[model samples]
Target: MQEFEEFIQEKMNPTNIFIKICTFLLLCSTLAYGQAGYGATTDSVYGSSLAILSSPTTLPLSPAPAPSPDYEYVNLTGLLTVAGPFSTFLKYLETTKLIETLQAQANDTDEGITLFVPKNNAFSNLKKVSLSNLTSDQLKQLCLFHVLPHYYSLSDFKNISGSGPINTLAGGSYTLNFTDDSGTVHIGSGWTKTVVSSSVHDKDPVAIYEVNQVLLPEAIFGTDIPPPAPTPAPMVAPDIAPVADGPEVADGGKGKGKGKGVAANSSTPSSSYRITGRNAWMWAVIVPLFVGLIVVL
Candidate 1:
């Protein structure tokens, strides 16, 4: 029983207990160090992933959209309504339904139309002839007479100038004449002769020119059309009078006066000396003669 107690005491010794406690502490520290190292490694990997996701990268951009074409339908009625004092012409166009025809031609770009619009004063100045007496068909023909089937710019008139009779929109015997005076385009319609005063609109499909006089077709009027008046002669400039030549009196008189004064001054001294010598000789001979006469007495 004493041996058994000694064995129990030895097993429960403080040194053994201390050694076991130290071993347990060492194991716990190692485990803790390993867990801390693992946590640090995990954090480093997660941070690297976040940095890669946050970085910027280059990429190709998409191209820009293309521009649209410039083709547009022209509005003739709206254009004439806004431009010029075309109210009178617009009235005639509406009255004869020629506006629709002109608008249709304007919509077509291939073989376009040319229009000549008269001003408000033009319709008012139709004194000798009267449009009020005309029939509906005659008025339509008159309105059609003002238009050409094909488009013609102010510059194109130069090509058609003196190119015989041009076919108008009226068709048949309805024709007109064109004459270009320098840059001006003159339109002759048998009864009326006028030039294009200004261009209201000149585009590819349509052209509108302003004229002073209303075009009167010979078909509506009789064939007994009056001849065109003669062109007035240009005024001549007055002739300038010729300038007469004159002598340089100032310089010439000054030189002549200077030369005369110099000659007169030069001769005066010599004449005075000769006259004084002759007078002295006469006095000497007269004094000697008086002394000899006194001695003889």
Candidate 2:
């Protein structure tokens, strides 16, 4: 009996040691997982429920939430208060009486909008060509070409790289391209200009992408300018060959027939030599004499 008790203790000791080792391993694993920011639940000896533990550290999330679009109902006049070169464009919009549409809102419902405004210099460049002289419909067409149907933020632009076209209210679309490593935006063929400021006045329910220049659709400017009237196809006078007045028909018949023969003979030129006709001589000789006179006179 004494030997058996000693054997039991020996077995119990190993089992307890194994249990302790397992507990130590489990604790280490929990700590490691917690450090890695994993959530864990542990059961306490006290008759309470499991305790949940969350990692203390958290990763910073990317892509902040988009701004609320609420104030876009304001017209072009209101936009002028917002800084940057857009103010000048707003003035032109007002002068052009485009503010009316921008300010108009539904009777009670609020809606969001996107306005792609060209810079003042863009208008100046356009004005130099006297495009403002174009009819109202044409001017509106020009303005609409700059606008997109949807509100787009700068973050949206980065993904829009490569050859992709977005339809505008302009009755056409503009192609998008990435011009810089930092994702500065450019629109239209060749990606000519950079987006100087993006996501301005976004809370106004309008997304405005302020680029360095006006975005003109390829169609608007791509057409070949008509070749200037092909230089009026030089007026060339037709070259009329002089007639030799071929030998008059001679009738060998004599007496009464002789009269007819003489008449035909009289109509014939006295010689076979070339007679410089009025217009013909002017081109043949007068042109040379005129050159000589130019030097002499």
Best by lDDT: 1
RMSD of each: 28.9, 23.5
* Per-residue lDDT of candidate 2, residues 139-230 (tens digit): 66666666555555666666666635655655444443444347666554332354646545664346666666765444555544333334
Which residue pairs does candidate 2 place in steric collision?
Answer: 71-204, 72-204
Return the lDDT, model 1, position 60. Answer: 72
Q: lDDT of each model, Cα atoms only?
A: 0.84, 0.58
- Candidate 1 on 154-273: residue-level lDDT in tens? 899999999989998889888989999999999988899899999998987788899999999888998797665689999999997553333324334433333344444444453434
Runs off by more than 4 Å, candidate 2: 1-76, 104-111, 125-128, 173-181, 189-194, 225-297
Provide the TM-score for each candidate, comma-separated: 0.53, 0.42
CA error at residue 227 for candidate 2, angstroms: 16
Candidate 1 lDDT:
0.84
Q: Residue 17 in candidate 1 has what lDDT?
A: 88
Scored by TM-score, the top model is 1
